[model samples]
Target: QVLCGDDRIDAAVTQVISNLSSPFRSGSLLVNKIEAFEGKELKNVADLSAVVVIKSLADTTVRTVRSSRGQSGAEPVAKLVVPALAPTPNYDAALKQLIKVCQEVHVPLISLPGFGDLAQIADEVRFTFLRQLKLNSTRLHTFLMNLVVEEGLEGLVEEVSNQLNRPVSIESAQFSLMASKNMGGTPASQQRSLVDDVHKSVRKQLKVADSNDGKDWIIPTLKVGKRLVAPIMLGENIVGYISSMVRPNDDMEAIAELLRPAALAAMIEFHQNRQTGPMFAATQKSLLRDLLLGGTLAASDQERMEQHYGFDMADGILVFAASALNAQGQPLALDGLPDSFGVMTEIEGTATVVVPYLANSGKTWQQVAEALQKQLKELVKQKPGGADAQIQIGAGRMSETTFDLAESYREARQALIVGSMMHTNKEFTIGYGELGVKRLLYLMIDHPELERFCEEIIEPLESYDEEWESELVPSLRVYLAEGANLNSAARALFIHRHTLRYRLEQIAEILKVDIDSQEVLLNLQIAFQIRDMMSGSTGKRG
Candidate 1:
């Protein structure tokens, strides 16, 4: 049923097959004609990527080509060709016009010889086309597999580009550029680097490829200006993407065919790497703990740590202490932190995270903190009782060396303590700079003298409030927080200024301390801070 040539013998055989077909027995050997075009003649028979049959005559057309571009506009990567027994009107003139157009576009010429009805054998013809497509797909798989074994991903991608005759790029799950094959000595037209573009695209889209559509891993081709992008998927998840400059009037079917093997290669690589991810992460965590504790490491050990964990002693790093409590008010595990960035470890029940500063990212620490907070917020939403989750993050000052990482960790812990008093809001990041006088007071909170002084200064006031369980302590806190501005304190407490004044006088009378003296006020403030620390309310005093 397949038309191999226009020879008489072949034509006779095609007619014979058409006559014997089931549709012929049903009263007609001629069903419907098919016409297909890419926009021009196919440069090679190998350019055929797939074969699709239009079973319903109503669906038949001269050509069906994808109009949209990029990952969002997914189309078959093949030349659409329809076979017919007879030509339409002006067939000769149309063929000539097609040949002229094919010179400038990818449209294949539509030409057919008038003969006996061939539509009755449409099923056989479509089946043969599919068989050919399968054979070609096998060859593509073989080539990609061989290339991967011989030259790895970079060379494999280059070969794919050569085969598809288009540019191809491979990116990691993080959207970082891994390898790319440039087309015809022309650079990608985007002003930004492809890596930057991919990052921006992923951030904006959240996913570069989506499989929720319940089809193949290929994301619909997304066109950015004159470029095309497709995602490489592992099962249902996207592992990376491939992008290229658009070729004018190019049939994307062939390009999509090439990406199938590329995606397979990417999936293989991703799982292979993931197999060792946990072991590698454990080793990295151990090394980080040792480094932060100032444990001596040999030069080889240091080199190994750097090579495997991507930690460089020369680079600046920051430590973050995230103290999380469950709804039960117990310390949560360090596993609560996101795995996207940083090395997190539990130190005495507190989650300590360390991340190297990305000097090239053009982001400040505050910006990084904001991003982490956002990620954590999203993470919490996925957990049970997330609405009740309480997470407080404290960031240390930037450390220039591993030796200073311990210092940063220590400062971060203290910041968490001091931050609780300075900022009452939970589930946020507070840096060491936000710690003022509490910097020194925080370090001394565990001192017996400090605890004793706090007891002496604030115990009477606290005991008095306990007798009535009143708002005296809250009034004092707000009054101090307002820098002695009575109106501000009264407004904040939702009480009249006279009521606040009366409370202050009563507090002074019971404590037998001067309410107006700056010296007494400072002492009382220090005592209250110490008491909070001792009660395990402000931070981990022990």
Candidate 2:
């Protein structure tokens, strides 16, 4: 099935391989043919180097020269030459032949590279190529929103740095409209300082050398800081900067290119974070105020807000009132108080106590007052000794409504004011029954004219005749006026029963009336009521 030919066939086969392997060129391969022979026609033709005269029956063009190896006397063999055969084949055999040819030619052949294999060597490199194109298109969208929801900007930076195996420092984080000027102008200087440091560090760490032909390339080293600063550009403007300090095994220019996309993502995220700061602060304030007022939002509502807006609801509440000391050590402005507590707007010139209506741990209004009093007492103790410091506290009333709060505030303030007048330097006071009335009475007692009126009413008794002043007159007045109860009269006057009886005898000697008589008791009772009424009415008019 096979035919042997002249050595010209070997020369033609070699030319075909050379033409296929060489880049595009002219006159590289030429086909040749020879007549079939029954046996080997050319002896020792392997070592012969000479042009063969090829003759062909077909009309293919051929150029030939006389054979130099044969004697001039011998007849030359005719040779036929034609165009070289094409080198097309099946995929499997082609690959095998290509490999074999490469081995024979001492050349290396490689198939197209895959992503998975490249990723194992350098994942950052792979991610960079993938995310850069996609992330650049999304620069207009605020990325900070994602950062805030996932974690804060700082946390995001830390995480990204960790994932990339780099040490990162975020600088000049700001948020505004895309077209806005540098909003952080004053702080830009500080940012520049950090940038400069990063630049110096990076330049020192990166070792670059020039080849003999003056081509620049980098060498690997780990002795110095490798710093990288990336500008986060949104559209035509730069929005922020990300600085990284790292030591990499390879050239960092490639690494910097890889980090650019992630930096852009982080910048977008930081911008969104800045936009929500005020909203977060406002939400926090509202929640704290609500809890202090004892209003409860639904758990679901809270969850929704916290999820959407990232508000925290775990803060504690406190309320306080300010009381300034007067010359006589009495607390002032203690009347006609408002129900709901207001935040202490100012307290530097005077002292204020912020009373929280609602707090954690089920503390009643009374307990709140007690705690405030304790705090105030501590403050007083810290003041200079012998300074005549005076403070009074009233019990707090618990209620959820702001309307009810005023009454409690008023009662507590009034009680404190009254206690200040009654007892000097009292730490705290609670209003109960008669004490509550006394507290109200002292509100009127502040006027000196009222005190004069009260004194005028009692003045007549001080100047009564000697017989009236004698123990008998006072004993009869107290006994008969006090419902003829001997023990009550004796107890009211701080006297023994026998001593009270003796005093009654003396009263009989002076007034000549039986102390037990109903008529006398009625008259005495009327006289005492008249005296009290006169004093009270005069004081009021004064």
Best by TM-score: 1
Model 1: how far residue 200 lies from native, Å: 46
**Candidate 1 C-alpha lDDT tens digits along 106-221:** 32222333244446445666566467667876887877777776677788778777777777777654335667887322133341243344334433343433434533323344
> Model 2 off-target regions past 4 Å?
1-371, 386-390, 432-435, 439-457, 462-494, 498-542
Prediction RMSDs, each to the true structure: 21.5, 33.2
TM-score of 1: 0.42
Query: On a 0 to 100 scale, what is the lDDT of residue 399 in model 1?
Result: 91
Per-prediction TM-score to the true structure, in the order listed: 0.42, 0.28
> What is the clash count for each candidate, in the order shown?
20, 22
By summed lDDT, the worst window of 10 consecutive residues in model 2 runs over: 12-21
| lDDT accuracy of residue 202 in candidate 2 | 32
CA lDDT for candidate 1: 0.59
User: Per-residue lDDT of 261-335 in model 2, one digit per residue for the tens?
Assistant: 556666555445433664333333333333333334456534543443222332322333435344465543322
